[model samples]
Structure formats: C-alpha cells, structure tokens
Target chain A: MKITCPSFKYWYPRLKSGKLAANDEQLAINHLSTCEKCRKAANAIEALIEDKIQPESDVFFSARLFARLEKSKPSHSVFIFRPVFAYTLLLSLSLFLGIRLGTYFYYQSSIPSENISISEEYAIHSTISGLDVFFQDDFNE
Target chain B: MDENEKFLDKLQSGDQQAFRILVEKYQPMIQAIGIQMFERSEDNEDFIQEVFIKIYHALPNFRRKSSLSTWIYRVALNHALNLNRKNKWKKWLMNGLNLIGSNEQAVPQMPGQIEENAEQREMRRLLNKAIQRLPENQRIAFVMTRIDGLSYAEVAEVMGISEAAVDSLTQRARQNLRKHLSTYYKSL
Candidate 1:
C-alpha cells in the first residue's frame, strides 16, 4: 500500500465539506496514500487545530477598565442631561406658543387702525351743510 | 433582566461588577482572537481591555439592532485589528526571528492518542502560532469559526460583513496558509 502525504490526507474532510473539490481531494488522498511524510504533516495539522484555546482573563483588567470608565466624566453627564433635555424642550414650546399668541393679538389690533383712518377721511370729505346753503344763495343770484 | 438586557442596563448604569461579568465571560473569546491575529505583545491584554471598555461605554447607545455578544465581538475584533496594524512592523521583525529560530529546533508535539483525552497543550501553542501568521481578515474569520465555533451568520454579524464574505475569508485564509506551507508540504 502506498503511503499518502499527511496534509492531503488531512484535507479529506474539508473536501467532503465541499470546501475542496473532488479533484483536490483526490490529489490530496493520492499524495497522502503514497507519502508517509505527508501523513505525519496531516497529523500535525490536526493536532494543532484540536488544541486551539480562547483568550485568558485577568480579573484585575476588568476592574481597572471599570475604574477608568467610572472615573471618565464625559459619559456621566448624560444622567443629569435627560431632564435638562426635557426642560429645554418645554421651554422651547412655551416660547413658541407665547410668540405666536402675541403676534396674533398684535396683528388683530393693528387692522382696526386702517379702518379708523379711512373713516376720518370720509368725515373730512363730507360736504358742509352751511356751505351748501351759501352756495344755494349764490346759485339763486 | 434577561442576560443581555440586564447586562446592558448595568453597563449603562456604569455598574463595575456588571462590567466585570461581561469581561470575564467574554475575555477568552477576545484573547483567542488577539493571540491568533498578532504575535506576542506586552500590550495585547491592554488591547483586549480597551475592547471591553469600549463595549461598556457604547452599550447604552447600542440599539438592540443586533445581539449584545455580536456587538461586543465586533468591538473586540476591530480593536484587535487596530492593534495588529499598529504593531505590524514589530510583528514582522519577530516573525523574521521566529523563522531563524524555528530552523534550529523542531517544536515538541503533543503526546496523546485518544480523542479529547490527549495532551493538546503543545499542539494548541503551534495552532496559535500558525493563526497569528494569518492575514488580519482571515485570522478574525478563522478565530470566529475555528476557535469560537460560531456559525457563519454569527461571524458575519460580528464582522459586519456578509456570510459569503466570511466564507470567502476562511477559504482565502486556508489558501494563504497552504501557500505558506508549500515548501514544507513539498518536502513532506
């Protein structure tokens, strides 16, 4: 029996997973079956993968991170900030309403001034009754 | 409070214990990625810490648009990559040294024959080294898939990329490794 290359032998599963095509798997299997060295290489790859680990934790690190974040003032300002936000919102609405009401009343009062001035001109333009009588005598003469 | 919401509430309130819980629960995941993506650095732990810190502060603003873990993972991955870029020159120099150093000694292999019963301590070390050499995107994807064992969709969420992108990343990473090992492969 021919010894296959270990790496090619190892990639067999990956091939089965469709990550490697049939041709690639065949080549790997062929080499693995023929080469003992390749088999060992494949074994090593397998060994390596089986040993992977997650990162270790340092409790102190978290403590310090918390300390830094806590001591960091920029983020804390948001706590008191929400109320201020609400207050400002109310303030803005009140100001807007007050300005709108004032403008409405002011404009309403201003319109009558134009009517008063037109009536004053109408009074002045009325023909005097005594002037009409004098003009009547002149007419008779 | 459900786990995520409670954690978020505390995080928003600046609860230190809550932060600790978050860190403790997730540090392993973050550290695994860091080790895989970067060579040994004294600053790695700091980078991980910063990642968590950012998550803690940003949690309040985090609309539940995504899961908390996914958001945290994204933060961790981005921080890890940023650290990787900042320390690239240093990593390159160390990699050169490692190449020269590896020539003289074949690292010891784990001795065990049983499934999950074998001493994987050493093999794990080698795996970490190999993962560290992977390109940034590949390393992150590999870490998410191989180390964290997250589904492709979850990995996509953490990566802010499509699932297709994650799949491609893993494939490309494997190809890169295959290329890197071509000489060793041919020799074998």
Candidate 2:
C-alpha cells in the first residue's frame, strides 16, 4: 500500500469529513504512522480546525458597555452643527447679503442725475438771498 | 412583532433599558469575535463595546431584511476586521518590542509544566497569526464557520455571499492554514 503525497491529499478531505471508506481510512492511518511529516501536517490541520479559545467577558460587561454608551451619546446640540444645518445657514446668509447688496446697487443706479443738480441749485440760491439782505442794509445806512 | 423587532423599536424610541438588553444579548458573540480577532486580551472588552455602540447607532436604520442575530454577526465581523486592519501595524511593533525585551527565565514554573504550556501558547499564537495573515474575506469565512460555529448558510447570510461561496472560502482558508502551519512547524 504505497500512498503518494498526492494520494494522501486526495484522501485528506474525506478523512477530515469522515467520509473515507473504512479500508481507505485504515490505509491513511497506516501512512500517517509511517510518515512523520504527514502526521505533523495532519496534527497541525487538526489544531487549526479546532475551536479557538473563547474569551471570557467580565460580569459587569453590560454595565460597562452602558456606561461607555452613555459617555459617547451625542448631545442634542450636536444637531445644530450638523453639516445639513451648517450648509443651510451659509446659503441663507449668502442669499440675504446678495439681495441687500443688489438692492443698494439698484437704488444707487436708479436715482436720476437731475436730482443731484437740483439740490446743488437750491444751496446756491439760499446763499445769494443772504448776500442781498447784507447789500440792502448797507444801502439803507 | 417579533422579539427583535420590538427590541429594535424600543431602541429607536430611546429606550435605554432595551438598548442594555440588546447589548447583554449580543455581548458574548461580540466577545468571541474580539477574542479571535485581537491579539491582546484586554482589547476584547473595548472592541465588544465599540461593536455594541455601533449597533446602537445603526439600529434605527436596520430594516428587518435579516434577523437581528445575523445583522449583529455582520456588524461584529465587519467592525473586528476594520479594527484588526487599523491596529495591525501598531500591534506588530508592540509585539516586536515585547519579543526583544521579554525575559522567559524570570517567570517561575513547574519543572515540566512551563515547557508544555509555552509550547501550547506558541502554537496557538502561530495559528492566530496565520489566520490573521489570510485575506479578509477568507479569514471572516473561516472564523465564522470554524471558530464561531456558524453553519455555511448562516455565514453566507451574514456575509451576503452564496452558501457555495462560503464552502469554497472555508476550503481555501483551511488549505492556506495547513500550508502556513506546516511551514511553521517545520521551521520549529
């Protein structure tokens, strides 16, 4: 019963799955007994397949988790600075500032030039009337 | 409503007690994952807490597409993998430093007990390292199926892969582990 490495490989899955025929399983057992390398490989594979060490949780695990959860809970104010609110605030402020600037510019551009010239004429006329009063007083004296 | 749905509803409605119940129910599963995934024992508690915290935040958005257990498995596995990736480099450096500074002779042990225990620990550590070295999907598949005792169908559901895919991944993972362990034992 000469079992090649490839033959062992073929039988290995069946051996692990317990699906190998009784004679084939005996043959594999014989081969493993004679071959130290194959036996070591089999042991290593078994160890790998074995259940891993289960970690034990502390008795207060739930309490600890709750504590941590409480500590990490997001405050209500966190919503105020959320990206959605921040973006909305920025857009509204920009729109308001844009409208205000636009209105100011429109008013500046819409006022007639004649209004400015008429205001200047009123100031000169008032000054001339004051000068006439001074001349009339001098003539009466 | 099912127990999970009721629990989820309470959680979404700001029921702290319900959230605690949820954490209590899943703590062992999360701890199991953390123990397998993390090298440090102390990190398991923190890792489990993080998983539950994530579940808490994500619970409201959880549609009942999968069972709560399956969803929790997915979250735990994903979080563990992410944490494993993020901490890999740091863990390696710390391990290296420990190896350099370690004094094996300082600890007192029984005449034969020390050698046996050391060998066992070494083998376990090597096995863990091999599993960690595997690709993410394969590692998850292997851990879920072998370590966590999940059936292929359950693993497939949690991983969102086909049952056949789970079978293939587990097979490949086993082969890879065998190769790694054989090489490592030969070197030893």
Write candidate 2's Cα lDDT for B1-188 as tens digits: 87766777888887988887777767766766665676655666678888888988898898878888898999998888888878877667877878535522122111123455655566666676677789888888887876444567888999899999998988888777765665555433
After superposing candidate 2 on the true structure, give the runs of residues whose Cα lies further than 4 Å from its correct spot: A1-31, A35-41, A52-58, A76-141, B89-116, B186-188
What value does the lDDT take at residue B5 in candidate 2? 69
Fnat scores for every prediction: 0.38, 0.30
The global C-alpha lDDT for each of the candidates, from Candidate 1 onward, is 0.63, 0.71
* Every candidate's CA RMSD: 16.1, 13.8
- Give DockQ per model, in order: 0.16, 0.15
Candidate 1 segments exceeding 4 Å error: A1-30, A49-141, B1-3, B90-135, B185-188
TM-scores for every candidate against the unseen true structure = 0.56, 0.63
- lDDT, candidate 2, A19-129, per-residue tens: 678888888888888988778767766865665534344568887777888899877777759888999999999999999899778756766656566544444444446
User: What TM-score would chain A of each candidate receive against the reference chain A?
Assistant: 0.36, 0.45
Backbone clash count, each prediction separately = 16, 0
